[model samples]
Structure formats: C-alpha cells, structure tokens
Target: MESLAPALGLGWDRQLGPSLPLSKVTVSAPEKDKWRRIEPTINTIWPIVEKADARAREFVARRRAATRAAA
Candidate 1:
C-alpha cells in the first residue's frame, strides 16, 4: 500500500501536508517531490507521532465537515 502523501498533491508545505487535503490545490507547483514529503522521523518519536497523527486526522475531519456544512 502507498501513503496518503501522493493524494495530498502539490504546493502545500512538504513538512505539514495538511492534517489532510480535501479541496483542490490552493497553489500550484511543478515539482512532484513535495507531495511525497513526510515529516522527518526519528526512532524515539515513531510511536508518539503515530498517536498524534491519529488524533489530528480525526480533528481535521470533523473540522472540515463543519466548515463545509456552514458554507
């Protein structure tokens, strides 16, 4: 399986590719590398990052839904 990084698309900061990208790119760039970029991980933070990412995803999802509903 592949990571969601590819699905996030171009132009967003590689280091913080959203909690997720549900809309079209707000900015455009030619390079593809930026999309596959992941946060630089170190051994100690592996489990900690996983837990944080799970919460981030849930929070972002709810926020997106609320924003869409309000719009």
Candidate 2:
C-alpha cells in the first residue's frame, strides 16, 4: 500500500516526519487579505471554527506521533 502511494502521485511520505511549525512561514498582508475579507462572517461562527481547528490539530498530532513511534 505504501509503495503504491508514490506511483499514484499521492505524497503520503511528506506527512510522516516532523510536522511543519506554523511560525516558520511568513505570510504577507496581501496573502492574508482573503481571510481578512471574511473576518466578519468568520467572527459570526468563530466557536465552530475554533472547535474544528482543535480537532484537526489533535488528529494530526496523534497521527504524527504514531508514525514516529512506528518508525
């Protein structure tokens, strides 16, 4: 299954090692404008967004830890 991933152009290996830290990326104001434009709408449902983000982070952390342990 792992061997088939590369042939399919599905780079699963990229997610296996240490995760990228968000702080390492530098985003310019223009790049962030899209989100800024939606700020009002996002604020209306901020709680839902926060909850989903937390769940996603938890999922990634568990997956990364499991992969490292296997390695």
Across residues 15-69, which tens digit of lDDT does each residue of candidate 1 receive?
6543555447656544567644543545556787888989878866766566567
State TM-scores per candidate. Answer: 0.38, 0.49
lDDT of 1: 0.56
lDDT of 2 by residue, 1-71 (tens): 35445433356644444544446464743354668877899899988789889987786676666666777
lDDT of 2: 0.63
lDDT for 39 in candidate 2 is 84
Candidate 1, position 59, lDDT: 69
